[model samples]
Target: MVSDRNMLANILRTELQIHKSSFILGSHSLICIFIYSSFIHQHGGRFHLSPLREL
Candidate 1:
């Protein structure tokens, strides 16, 4: 029974870590997109296709 409890605790801890990391990554990407869009907006809403073409 004690081993089962330990396993459950470990699983919960790993799950929390995964969620935290994912949230951080998601927020980072969101911020990047927001900044990029704002930059384009400042430039009269013209999206430069050169960068996409490079990709």
Candidate 2:
């Protein structure tokens, strides 16, 4: 179960990084990214999504 959660987190992080540049180009995309980051922060803990902090 823990591994599955970590896998999901990894996938999410990868996807976020892949699209992050494009996201910064649009206002709506910024909102979506903020929501995604907040959701991850709440559910996955800061450690799991620490890479996003650099963005």
Candidate 3:
């Protein structure tokens, strides 16, 4: 039979994991993927940026 302490520990661990996942993929990473796909695809026929611009 499992003790109450062990059951509580398991529940707490699972809750911690769920909370930790919230910030795994912030907006910055998502924007990077979007920009890369838009700027570097279609044989370079996508959005045209001035030389002074940088992502």
Candidate 4:
């Protein structure tokens, strides 16, 4: 029973870590995109900095 509890706790900890990492990754990407767009606009859309523009 103690081992089961330990396993459950480990699983929950791992899940939380994964969630936190992905959230961080998502926010980082958002910030990059915002900066990239801002630069493009400032440069008069001539830079073509992001390949994601075709999407």
CA displacement after TM-score superposition, residue 9 of candidate 4 (Å): 0.3
Model 4 Cα lDDT, one tens digit per residue, 1-55:
9999999999999999999999999999999889888877877887774646643
lDDT by residue for model 2 (2-34), tens: 999999999999999879966667878788788
Report lDDT per candidate. 0.84, 0.76, 0.69, 0.86
Model 4: residues >4 Å from true position, as ranges? 48-55
The alpha-carbon lDDT assigned to residue 36 of candidate 2 equals: 76
Q: Which candidate is the best by lDDT?
A: 4
The CA-based lDDT of model 4 is what?
0.86
* Candidate 3 CA-lDDT value: 0.69
User: lDDT by residue for model 3 over 1-55, one digit each (tens)?
Assistant: 5788899999999998877775565666887777667666743765655422754
Clashing pairs in 4: none
- Report how far residue 27 has shifted in candidate 1, in Å: 0.3
TM-score (C-alpha) between model 1 and the true structure: 0.80
Give per-candidate clash totals: 0, 0, 0, 0
lDDT per residue for candidate 1 within 1-55, as digits (tens), equals 9999999999999999999999999999999798778768767887776644433
Assess candidate 4 and give its TM-score to the true structure: 0.80
